[model samples]
Target: MVQNGQVFKILVVDDEMSMRELLEILLLKHGYDVRCAESGSSGIEAIRSDPPDLVITDIRMEPVNGIEVLKKCKAVSPRTIVIMISAYASTELAVEAMNEGAYDYFPKPFNNEELLSVISNALRNRGEEQSVSDSREGLLYFGCLIGESAPMLKVYETIQRVAKTGSNVVITGESGTGKELVARAIHRQSARRDRPLVIVNCGGVPENLVESELFGYRKGAFTGAASDRKGLVEAARGGTLFLDEIGELTPVLQVKLLRLVQDKTIKMVGGTEEIPVDVRIISATNRDLERMVMEKTFREDLYYRLNVLHIRVPPLRDRREDIPVLARYFLSKFTKDLGKEIHKVSSYAMDILCNYEFPGNVRELEHIIERGVAMESSRIILPDSLTLSMHRRKEQERTVPAVRSEIPIENFDLDKHMAEIERRMLQQALSQAGGVKLKAARLLGISFRSFRYRLLKHELATEDELKEE
Candidate 1:
């Protein structure tokens, strides 16, 4: 008997014979119980009988297209993951697919990594329970941070081991990447689970109050110290203290923190006694402390002290495979919160969310889902509810996505249209400006920023030199 968690059953529906055969072979080789349909009609029938963990389909197909397949899957199983693939490159079409109900769209001539990324995300998003469910402390699944991608699985395993240690840990990732959640998970699994878990936002506090916040203040210590106050560290005594955004600590604050971590004691303001506090310190930050240390913005000593047990939260883009589950989690959250009985996301909408580069990470995704809940009148969240600025400046290229794309289309050119439009616009602006940024800005009726942006984009000037000229 096929059981859940032993092996996942995946479905691939495509009109093209080669595409269907190739995907089935790949999935089967990977130990998945894979099923395929050459047309949407057969695919729908298969799903109605035995629902699959995930579905991958081609946007352009015969008789029954991928769109139809996506609708049917959602109708039968709202949480079933769906990915749409197309040979034609079109953002307008992709946006439409997202609105329609597909989890993500893969442009043809894609990379193997890209296709795999989409598939992984789609499946991770499938969090629907086919039967009656149970919840603990408002969590759909306790101590479960779901992701099947290699990087996330590694993180999961690391968490299992690290939770046993009382040593300090540094959890790192981009904003909205769920650092706090990871910290809490660690705290929940730790020996001090019965003790209180204290959280202090290093970046959110004012500089003047930081010292007192970490170390208790005597009644007459400062202006606000009308009564003796116990700092977060003291409150977390015999438990755990979660310091988020640790890299934001100033040099002065870092010295105090270092003393606490190094000496195992904190001196209260205006108090002569050195109070030894027993607490597990788990620090999190999106910033690169190593780079910050080189820049002299962060303390290297403090970083090493907290880096003993490190848990890195991979960004949503890095593990697109997890997007589906995370999205569904957010959906269920909003559904209950909004008192709306929504069942599933449109296949197309799911496609856009799974494929897009969520620069803001999972937090950004949570916001999107919340917005979708408000906008969605019916049960399913529509892709149009997503407010990502596709035209915004490309995200910083410091780190490549952790997971690569899957299902690369052979001989397909990537981002050709966007490049073509950009080339024509730059050439026209230069012609109007006679190769001057200011002149081009005036001719294009754009700001100096726009003119400089075009010049820098077309390599007419270096990024740094663009402002100088």
Candidate 2:
């Protein structure tokens, strides 16, 4: 495939001449620069002379095997992507190839379309990495948000376009996806940059006090009002007011908020006059406001008034390509904050993170990296430092003991081995349940008291967990 007027080169290595010719024709038809290697030895020679963008090689070959060729290619050019194809593919071989740094493995008689898609994605990821590497701090970082993915670029463009105007904006996304950061970016780029940007959590304020809290109360308006006080709306004059979780506003509060949005005016509690306020309204919500309006939970008029412009913050799973960049960014931030010298995340740890589906989005990733930095005793963060809740971690736990069981009796120390296994299981259960002792205890099929005892025994419980109990 071609990118930026440069054709991607693919090297196909196979012992069979027909297989080599077949792949060459298939790749060449798809507008790629195809090169053929008749054997693993030839593949290594070709890679040394000129490293291609990607390599597709068969696993079995006489003398020099494809695994050896993979090692040589990676050693020669670490950025080169390798895909292994074999007729005799097994779980062990596939796992071995992956652990040895192969990008992906394909069994014989694989779907042509699937292979093409995999190649496209691998090259695209490499390109994205190259782009981010070129201007890491400048290109990808927008205010507090960090990402170079297409979704984020769209969000950035929308922010810039809408920031110049005074029109209302509604940002919708899942929680922890950085909707507030988008609001901040818009405010920062607007004409009222120097003015105060007042923030109000619509859901956090008490229903009884929300009206007075939003609109100022005149002197003796209520029992506690000894004098006139400006509310959030008035305090944000000539600036912007950010309403977070706007969906949580009660019907009465929604009416007051709607009045403010409609006429740029607000009425103080127990006051007779309407006060004009020249503040731009920016609202954010994790709930679906459209659905709320249809259900008559949120006012329809206020929905349109606030949603004149819309922006959706993409979740972390949708932008997996940025995980490494964000991980490194957080690594740098936490390292300096904690006064640590940790430099990077181990390759396996990063792989684990990238493959994970972050249900809590970017905010969760930030916390993960911070914990990794704090937990790591070495210069690099390893898989053990990452507290992930993925099912794959459970699978890994099951596989570990099986591998350990195969260790020679002479080399095995039963006490140490048993202790290690117990420590890992406790940590895994705790992490999976997000450090909730009761849930973790249930996962281990034990009582809370027993779980607490085991945690103390293994030193796996955090000080916070202990204190909470």
Candidate 3:
């Protein structure tokens, strides 16, 4: 369609001449600059020579299928949105096409109005996405962190600024906010990138062993010290050492660590000589170290040493705009690991994710998407596929109205009351979902299998009517 003095170009690819002509006429009638490709190979060539604003390709083309064409379009021009159509559409093929970067998939004989609407919306969104990308070029940092939110951009700028120095850094954030990732980014961007970067969780190890873990021990220094052993600090010599949960370090261990940070040398346990070492210390903590210092819990002197350069990772809830990017990233990651074909997350599912206050932060989002990919049976992740936290579930359950009691407490028939309420909910959910059991199941936050079983239990539908979804 023409907008802002520029006409949107659309390429229609199909083996059937009639189908191609029909699409070309339809698209041209809508004012789109339309081109026809009789085969997927030609479609790929057209995309390479002059990438269109959008592509409409049939999935079953010979020599090169729509999935291949989609991949080539993404490779050649990532902004070129693709829509896949197939007369013989299957979930597997749809999933593969979506994972390969098709904007949407349609079964053959699709509604004309729906197809046109999708095309219009896709191009509009493509324009908006291009604008956003242009505004925030190089949004991804260190090939690991992803976001263009204000909080994340600030973090990226700080990483770039501090990564050049050898000063000790303290990364503060909630437990799952990716503090370790920020530490890794700092180390990767720092001068010691070529050297070893060792990570140790201060809270994971026992308090008794933390001292020896941070400073090497001599042979026969203790009963279990069978031979001379190098500590994690020594292992990180000439590079960087990431101490996660630095606030969890015991007072005595903190003193030992403070000396190392102060002197740049460590005296092995039961050894007289102090060995000099060069390393940048990056410590991360979810706790309020400042409060702990006031409370006389954490050592202030050590805190100052690690706080020379500070970075605070914003929680996922604070950067809701990043949820879509993070969710897609995790989807791509888990799909390959689980050998699942799922790629796209439904708009409804994404809405649920973006609205969620992820108490567990980015790590929780990763787990949610990973679980979604594993649980999803279709090409797109639906609301029913997402399994949020139990706390959130409980919170949702609280929002649901309590069942009204019609009988006196002494005469209450608990079982019958519960059954009646259950039946009523089932009917209401079914009605609201427009007789679609899957949607009804999602509405009630129940599984399709469970909904079907309940339907049988309550005689809501016959066996034939409630067959496998």
Candidate 4:
């Protein structure tokens, strides 16, 4: 009733024609476009005819149960959400329906109000999802913040819980870890979602103009202020203002920002009038704000104000298991963007990516995929497609004597060929570096950290321990 077709286009499927008609009449009277199907086969046919936005079908129906209908809908037109209804919504039936992709299930003689509310909420969420899907460029980030690590799961759960609230959020993570994504996601899910979401890089803005940029400027505010200009805060009214690198804000700017948070008002530069504003603040910083506060560079009070809710994005190395998922996602994105035919990564290439510690996190992985898509000739991507600097470092590591403790061949009877290669490589690296462990690691093209791990794993002795012996 509020908006036509803007709401869910619903199809009512049931063995009883009376039930179908009653549902259709009830929904249509309330301003929903409703259709009726008396049998499972008919419902499936109607779905194939033109998929409805939502399907409400009875479970335990003749010929095809709700599960079959749900599965067919999922396979045929996955976007159409399915809701199951039955005379008895037993646990088993509900589970089966849900497992087969039913969005929800209602028992016969449903509580009409609850059913309506549930339907409305589902429809609203579906609308939100569709809107997000449209905005997703080539690459997509759910929660915009990417991570599949256990630590990241906690972060995702927190985002979902806190996004609906109007409270401020402070995101902390190393650089290139997608802090902006988290801020954007919170804005997209917030009450002010319909409003504009603006971003300001606090570190890059000049100290003298930071205040003016954040809180508008009058025509005569400064030498370059030719006309009245709205600041990011005013522009982001009723929405969110993301402040990146908050640790870089000058002491003077910090006080002003804190005032805005406390009073929900901003005074344009060189203007006496105070403008009442409603803007949610989402701040992020890679720097140690706590340490900065200790050094008196940042105000402790301001830190507390921005830290209302905190979400930390983990480094990509910590979530190696998600590398392939992200890689494939990016590959598909770039393939379409670059118009390349590359479809997949070779297993060996995948192994290299998973094991490598991605210092630049998701952003770096995206670049690698983009590069691979450009360089790949075969339909499948190979390791050479990625200019992974780390692999060169790995080979250098394999050459170090400290890479593995030298076990006398007789002392460490091992696979003949593998042991022979290990001894020869170690000896060559030692000879090349004059047996200097640090130099040996460098010649081997590996970091001391990586060499250390390999040495211990291989039960190889370090030259330092050998000298002590």
TM-score of 4: 0.54
Clashes of 3: 0
Candidate 2 structure, TM-score to reference: 0.59
Task: Please give, for residues 1-469, the per-residue lDDT of candidate 1 as tens digits.
Answer: 1334557788888888998888888777767788888888988899999998788888777788778888889889987877778887655666556666666667777566557655664454345432223232123323556555677768767877998888999999988887888888888988999999998888633454567768878887754356777787999999999998898787888998888899989988878888898888999998888899898888888888989988888887888877777788888888899898766665456767877777788777788888888876654555555654421323523232322344233322346445545656665676555455576677778888876776666654567544323
Off by over 4 Å in 2: 1-140, 388-469
Error of 3 at 117 (Å): 13
Q: Which stretches of candidate 3 lie over 4 Å from their true place?
A: 1-123, 126-139, 388-469
Ranking by lDDT: 2, 3, 4, 1
- Tens digits of lDDT, candidate 2, 337-417: 999987667555676788777767788789999998898776767666787453253133211232276665332467868
| CA lDDT of each prediction against the hidden true structure | 0.74, 0.82, 0.81, 0.74
Query: Residue by residue across 190-214, what tens digits does model 3's lDDT show?
Result: 9999999998778633454566667
Between which residue pairs do clashes occur in model 2?
Answer: none
Q: Is candidate 1 or candidate 2 better by TM-score?
A: 2
Clashing pairs in 4: 1-31, 393-445, 396-444, 396-445, 397-444, 404-460, 405-460, 405-461
Model 3 TM-score on a 0 to 1 scale: 0.60
**Candidate 3 C-alpha error for residue 141, in Å:** 1.1
RMSD of each: 14.2, 12.4, 17.3, 20.3
How many Å off is the CA of 207 in candidate 2? Answer: 1.5
